[model samples]
Target: MQPSHNDQQVDLANTAGDLVPANPSTFSDDDTLSGLEKGPSTTVSSPKIPIPEPADVAEKEPFLYSLRTHKYFITVTILLSLFTDMVTYGIIIPIMPSILEHMGGDSTKTGVLVAVYAAGIMSSSPIFGVLSDKMSSRRKPMIIGLTGLLIATIIFMFAQVYWLLIVARFFQGVSGGAVWTLGLALMTDSFGADEMGIQMGKALIGHTMGMLGGPPIGGLLHDAFGPKAPFYFCLAFAALVIVMLSLLIEVRGDEMQEIRKYAVELRARDLANGIEVKEVVHTSLWKLVTTPRMIAAVTVTTLEAFDLSSLEPTLPYYLKDRFNLTEGQIGLVFIAFTLPTIVSPLAGWVSDRYGAKILCCCAVISAGCFMLVLSIENKPLWGIVLTLVGIGLSTSSFIAPILGEISAVVRRTGDKAAYARAFAIFNIAFSFGMLIGPIIAGYIYHGLGFKWNCITTACILFAFVPIIFFWMGDRKAKMEDVAMYEREEEERKRILAEIAIIKAEKKAAGEA
Candidate 1:
């Protein structure tokens, strides 16, 4: 133990040599080793090895922070932009008769203008939607659309001839189509699944106000000044939207990133757990057209739009012919239709709690029933009031819930492009309905009468009830299939765990 210093040093060297491998053959034959032998055998230091932190150990964002961040600005911007467009679109409704009279155009020609605007919207929506996806930027599309809307408004403001106004309206429709489709996309990118319905409901409220207020304001302004006043107002509103958008920050980044991250993590977890993820087949427009929920929702929306288009253009004419109501009176009837918008959030809440299918079916049938009542009723004021209230409440009740459901399905299908495509199809159906509805209503009103036309519209609405039932049944069956799959997954996991335990026990025995 108390040996000399040289002996102690030799023992330490022997212990260190024992730690290294005994095989000299493991050393490489290189010029570096020959230089080392001549230079007194220098030792090299090894680099430190680093361990990576687990992905799951990363910090989770607070729920409230996740919910509130970036949404306020985006939601406000979307609301303002959408409100401007809605006002521009609806302002013409109250002033339609006056403008036609001033231009020496008949009711039929006015109906044609409405149809043309809808057609423009339908045609432009898909193009804008596809462009939005390709561009991957809402800012540019929104700005461009708002700018076009402003230019269109200016053209509309200065137009003297009916043809000029029609041309301006067509441009306005193109801009409006982009605004509506892209605005929804922006919101979807900002909000997640749980909050989307509420935020969308709020946005719809703003839109409803524009729809409700714009016609009345236009009516008042037209009555006070002239037919061109609404256009000037729209121009100012469009300018305001541009200014607001410039000041606002984009909110889509965080939400989109979160969705991508979540998707990646879920896929990774499935792979690590030895689960096979199903591959979805991608296709073109035909694939989207054939999706059952999409088809059903689009059909219902289009038919509903058709019924609405038929009724809206003919309403002012019908009222004037029957009761000779003033512009203000007509505006009031329009307001009645929008009155239910005040309760739309409540409707959305109810829809969230109850199923969308029930709400949609009930609302559609109720609206049809009320339209039938309008056809039978003799008193002009009562009929207008009841019809407006019924249609408003019913339509509002259905819209939020059905849209929520469709959005869910689109997400489940794992296609971001589907939203835009779905909306494009919706607009096409809507436009087709608009083109057909007014022409049919105009012909029926001109040839047959007002009462029969209303009855026909009511019957057309009732036709959707059976269709809704069939659609809802299919949705129920899909849910059942999902439940069965989940149960099977649970059972499979249990069996796998049992097998793994048996294998681990055998390994332990072999080691022993």
Candidate 2:
């Protein structure tokens, strides 16, 4: 007859009990006591190995076995997706005014079109973020977004009138929001907090490269082959992104973090070494966003987006009218503003150490000063270039800090937190900035001229200094919380070690 499960456990315990030392002096009393205290709620016994049902394993493995699921590969796939969108977005920037001019429009009309794109992103981010989390899969939402983006690009390619072009941009922004929100969620799933900052910085490299090259490439292509050439270039990159995405196979939480059946020492060591599992708490979206630090971080994201986008409506016209610069030369000037941001990874390393308060305060102030200088009307080409270079260096310093802060707000929850919604809030703020920047900056440029536009932008940036200082930073509260967690981890390790010893003795006695 088969032994009952409880009978088997008792018989096994009796057999292994023989190996225990009678005096019990070899073990630490504190550790043994702690385990006893914790163990009354559940029996501490030898672990049983799990056997996956054959049919279940077969179903999951058959197709997934052929795909790449490594964490590094996931990063690459997401980065490629980001780069594709950014390149296409920027490739059209330098040519937008020209497209308008063909339709008997000006920079003000171009500003409205740019704002429409941002409006799409702002409206779509939260919807996609909610869908991505509820759906419990990143790849499907990402593919759907990409397909829609391609369709929008096709429309943009052949748009003969201004309103049609605006419609294309709005749809393109919606799809772009999906890619960014889900891509960030996927990255958060794959990486732990310790490395997330650097990864985010590296991710922004895609944005930086796109801004650095897109306008120049667009301007040059428009000059050489016509407006259609730039759109074709974007289409090709999007196709390659589809291939990279197809190679990815998403790794779910249980599969990615499998543990041995009864590896007590490994578990204890892992907790001690900073790989932690915390007490679960369901933080609401509003609660996360309303926190002081989070608000500051979101505000900074908006301002930086504004800082870059404000240039789009104002700078192109200013260059054409003031310096008589060609489209290619206007695009080249933007390179000065974008080139310095390539060191984002290094800046991320800094954020990990020093914190956001110093970076945000200093960056905005310096950028304002540079903008004030750039506003001077008599400056030659060299002076304007120098001012842009300064703005780039100063403004780029804050990107990684705000990004790190945004992730840091929820990172203590470890694997339990929802990342898509958090980043969706970030996207909302960023897109809002992009939406308002062009409208305000373009209005000022059209009414008061370019000088007042720069001055007004600088004044607005300077006003944010105190808010940045008051709210954005590394807080003592976080340090105290980390200390508390570490102490709890020590207690947990001791308890686990005692359990391990008991299991070892039981197995040895059973063998005897």
Instruction: List TM-score per model, in order.
Output: 0.73, 0.76
Judged by TM-score, which candidate is best? 2
The residue ranges of model 2 lying beyond 4 angstroms of the native Cα positions read 1-67, 253-281, 412-415, 475-512
Question: What is candidate 2's lDDT per residue for 1-512, written digit by digit as tens?
Answer: 32211111100111111221111221123222122212122223223323222221122443443336655567677777777776777777787778887798776887888788778888888898877655546777888888888899999888899889899999988988998888887876555444556677777777666655677788888888887998888888777777777767654422212112234444454456554432234556787787677788888888877876787778888988989877778878877877787667777676666666876788889988998998899899988888998888877776676766765565433313356778889889888888888899888998999899889879988988888888775634233223322332333233334444545555667832
The model with the greatest lDDT is 2
lDDT to native, each model: 0.62, 0.67
| Residue-by-residue lDDT tens digits, candidate 1, 93-144 | 7678777777886567767877777777888988877776544456667788
Model 1 regions more than 4 Å off:
1-69, 254-283, 473-512
